[model samples]
Target: MAVDLENPSNYLTTRVRQAVNWGRKYSLWPLPFGVACCAIEFMSTVSSYNDISRFGAELVRFSPRQSDLMIIAGTISYKQAPILKTIYAQMAEPRWVIAMGACASSGGFYNNYSTLQGADRVIPVDMYVAGCPPTPENLLYALTQIQERVEREGLVPAAVRHAGRVQV
Candidate 1:
């Protein structure tokens, strides 16, 4: 016997997942970790003109414990790397890291011996915003991308720990 019945339950489940994803995409709280020049642009994104609040991410918390997304917005020097790592450590599970601006992405112009060369070397970056100092609009775009990434991952609640010396 051959059965030709369509499964309506499968379709409903798919639609439900899509709707949930859409909602989460619009509500991202980005914790701006601005250190230097590019930080200026990071500030602009949260202001009225760019109005990052429209996307529901205006609650930029300075405390890592209260934030889930970390936006590294400037040059990260060697001295700052440990601090950045500490903050990343403080964030809860399922956190995301966005490297904003060329400086944070690849050390930009300060390719001297002090800069970290890239924030990724210190913390795991989920998105990278290009430009010596990206505009607020660009930052918003990156935020959208971060949202997309979150959706694609299905917002799975889990911790992503970087490999390091094991405490024995």
Candidate 2:
């Protein structure tokens, strides 16, 4: 069944799966990969006014092993691709990635040879927030989308990386 994030009350599912997803959606530990102008906007999302904590993602973890979501909020150079992949590899199962800007999503205006056209070239992106520097509200919206997807997927982890690099 399709579970709408805005109104899950209308949907029904097995109690166990619902319970698990309930806990998971309310507790998403995000790891911020900030490296450019968009990083500043991302910080604003965690500020008192925007308060990312309200979404249950207040615990911004630096360790990949401890985080379930990764917010890539800047341009990714080829030099940084390996590092990004390494951190992603370290994250546990059911991990999510949000490309939080034009730069992170498609390298923005840095269409140079050194810059990676998109983080998706090196990692799988679960969500993409457009704009040279997307507003904090957009990031928060992306977060909600992640929660929605998590709830919809139920007990099954969808971000599993298979040998063939399939994103299911």
Candidate 3:
């Protein structure tokens, strides 16, 4: 049903599903997997100037078990892929990943035997922020997109999410 903005009662009639979605969308906890230059921008995104807290993601958790969002902001070498997978596995259900920057998204210029072609090769990615080192605004925008996805899809079981990466 459509809500009538002119009527105050419409606000009170909000659906529980929408309310739950709103709560989950705003209260996202992120795991910062910063490994290179893009990590600098990731740090700046959380600084007072950028204020990632405004979106309720101010509390950055280093533990994978505590965070639902993982921001992979740098290159992922083959040696590190297993570690990243382990971290992703440790995270609670309904986890999400953001490949922040060209390096994290496609191994950037380090397309050699050491670096993985992309984070997707190791773990499932929910979003990809393009650029050598994306700006804070870009990261924020990616967060917003994640929020939107959560709002639309709501929370689902880990088995149902299907990131497509089989954990060996």
TM-score, per-candidate, Cα-based: 0.82, 0.86, 0.90
Candidate 1, superposed: residue stretches over 4 Å from native: 1-16, 157-168
Q: Rank candidates, TM-score, best first.
A: 3, 2, 1
lDDT tens readout by residue for model 2, 71-140: 9989999999899989988988778899999988988898899999999888888899988899999999
Off by over 4 Å in 2: 1-14, 158-168
lDDT of 3 at 139: 99
**Could you give me the TM-score of model 3 versus the true structure?**
0.90
Error of 2 at 78 (Å): 0.5
Evaluated with TM-score, which candidate comes out highest? 3
Task: Compute the lDDT for candidate 1.
Answer: 0.80
- The residue-by-residue lDDT of candidate 1 on 1-168, one tens digit each, is 654468655433357777887777776677778898778998888888999988778988998888888999889999998899888888886778889998899888888999888888867777889988898889889888878877776575434343352111
What TM-score would you give candidate 2 relative to the actual structure? 0.86
TM-score for candidate 1, please give it: 0.82
Candidates 2 and 3 compared by lDDT, better number: 3
